[model samples]
Target: MKAYLDLLQDVYDNGVGKDDRTGTGTRSVFGRQLRCNLSEGFPLLTTKKVFLRGIIHELLWFVRGDTNIKYLVDNNVGIWNEWPFQNYLNAQDLGNLEKHSCEWEERLDAFVIRIQKDQDFAAKWGELGPVYGKQWRNFSGIDQLDWVINEIKQNPTSRRLIVSAWNPAEIEEMAKAGLPPCHTLFQFYVSHDNKLSCQLYQRSADLFLGVPFNIASYALLTMMVAQVCDLELGDFVHTYGDVHIYNNHENQVLEQLSRAPKSLPTMSINPNVKSLFDFTFEDFELLNYQPESAIKAPVAV
Candidate 1:
């Protein structure tokens, strides 16, 4: 966790301030990386409370080959809520109201209500739309998960066990609709000694609001993959493109850096679950996670 704290502090001390899409401003840096050894313990942030349930459920959703927000919303996870909600707002007929007005909150609330009312809105808003699951499960004509499994069984030494989330065709569609993928790609490495390592390549990382969850999510994924492949968990590496500290979350990030981390939390996966795809949310446990108070930060959607 000191490693995590160091990265935040480094960004604050050296990052360049710039205006961003949300108009909330940002202190941004390029090409930062973080690595955690899963053999030690789960690399969940201990300086501030993180939403473990949300992380678990979101990972489960991705593994389930689900491309919908209903599972997330139903389970009280609000991580992906902003993207679909914002997309919905962008598509709405606002009737002379400014798009980025203070009424945005009210409009978003109404949009959620409308999604609950209209089946079509639910179908649209609930859909994940070319997110991690689609790419991991079915990337164009290539099934990444199957290929990874086959490689592990047959080769066990190939560096090609990679899952790419950045589809040029899908990016074109999302960009045309005014949405772009953030966490772009990921690659996995297998050691000769049968240690599984995962490296995530995030094209855009919202440090304050998104990085913590991203770290936990991918670490969990690495552990799961390692378990399925009967390999020891190695390092979870995070490679960022444009990592930014949101203006509103500056104080919170600073506070987190000042706090000393507690012991790393132990994540217990069901020993019987031998396949990554066979894991359910019930097959996981978090142990000895004691952290300080959560510092609420507004998401710049």
Candidate 2:
């Protein structure tokens, strides 16, 4: 995890300041990469405790071809709550309220409550339009995920095992109710040693909050695909484009950096599951993940 911490520090020390679409400024860098060996240990951030349950549930939701926040909110994962809430507030002409204000937070909390309890309201307002799940499973009517899994099984030597979530045609629609995909495209490579490796090209990365989950999610995805394909675990290489730390998160980042990283955790997946799409939340467990307290940071919506 030193590599992860080093990148955070590098961005902090060397990045250029840039304004973002969310109206929050950032210290931005370009073209950084992180690689983690799956066999070594799960590359979850140790400097601060990450919500593994949310990551697992979100990834599972992606694989399930779901684009709604209801499943996440129902599972008590609030990571995607801010985006939809902001869009709703704006669409409802309530954008006059300051976004970071107490009233705004209260309204957002109420919004999540509606999404959690009212299925009709959730179906109407909670749809994150054609985000990762929709693009991964049905990018222009192609099931990229299923296709990639089958391709890995049938033609491991083929170099075209790629899945992309960046549909330029639908980018505007996605941004209307949700966010553009940051972890954009990924390709899988099979080594002669019967190991499966994945490399993700993320178009944009929120280093402090998003990158940790991106690393863990792709690593877990690789592990799941490898299990279903009967191959050994390999490396997950994350390639980023516009990677940045939000300006407001700088203090939290420093707090995180001040802490020493503990040992990596081992993720145990149910070996009996031979299908990637068949994985459920109970099928996975993170063992020995002792880390420091959580450092809260606001999402730049």
Candidate 3:
């Protein structure tokens, strides 16, 4: 949680203003990194209560190779909602126009329509369009998921259990559709002492609106991966490329930083669930979570 606070402080103190696609403008910085120790506690942001349940389920959905928003919607997780909503917005207004040519007014109209008619909207824009799931599960003739699992079991000390979401071909397709992968790539390293560490390299990050969810999601992923590989959890290191705070979210970020973090929460996993895929949402437990309040921030998509 302190890591999150520190990140906000850094952006507020030194970020430079920049024009962005959303027209909300942004205060942005180049490179920054945050580290959290799983052994210390779950890194769910305590200043403003982060939706831990949603984070866990979303990570699980990603690992399960699901690209549809059905699972996320069913679980009440709204992290991925903005992307598809924005996409749907772009689709309705642009109507197959050359990808990046949609006018801002049309995009806003699309957003309005999407929130009103979710099912139809999802049918059109819900697909992540060969984003993270496709890349992680099947990466250009290389099955990263299978490779990581097998490598973890066979050579648990290897540093090659990596999953990348930035597929060049897919990126071309998404760019044609007027979108690009944000949390672009991730790598996992294992120490000889059997400690599993994960580093996520995000090529684009919306700091105020997205980083909290990103932190919780990846930290949970690290914990789950460690459990499956039968190794101790190490650090969850997040590296960002273009981290920005949207103009509308500046006050919210400051409000969150003003609140002090509560005691760290403990996440308990079912011991009997030996395999990663065998565990369900019910098998996970959260204990001693006390947070101030939910700080609402609009997504800049």
Candidate 2: residue 201 lDDT (0-100) = 100
Estimate the overall C-alpha local distance difference test score of candidate 3.
Answer: 0.77
| Higher-ranked by TM-score: 2 or 3 | 2
The lowest-lDDT stretch of 10 consecutive residues in candidate 2 is 91-100
TM-scores across all candidates? 0.91, 0.98, 0.86
Query: TM-score of predicted model 3?
Result: 0.86
Task: Please give, for residues 1-301, the per-residue lDDT of candidate 2 as tens digits.
Answer: 9999999999999999999998899999999999999999999988898999999999999999999999999999999988888878888899778977899989988999999889899998999999999999999999999999999999999999999999999999999888889999999999999999999999999999999999999999999999999999999999999999999999998998899888999999999999889999999999999988899998887
Candidate 3, run of 10 with poorest lDDT:
94-103
Q: Of the candidates numbered 1 and 2, which has the greater TM-score value?
A: 2
Reference-based lDDT, each prediction: 0.81, 0.94, 0.77
Lowest lDDT 10-residue stretch of candidate 1: 172-181
Residue 85 deviation, candidate 2, in Å? Answer: 1.3
For each of the candidates, give the backbone clash count.
Answer: 0, 0, 0
| Candidate 1 Cα lDDT to native | 0.81
Candidate 3, position 32, lDDT: 95
lDDT of 1 by residue, 1-301 (tens): 8888888888888889988877888899999999998899899988899999999999988877677777777676767776677666556754345544779768766766665567777787667576677777888877788788778778877767777878887876655333566877778888877898999999888887789999999999888888887889899999999888988888888888889998999999998998788888899999999988898888776
User: On lDDT, who's better, 1 or 2?
Assistant: 2
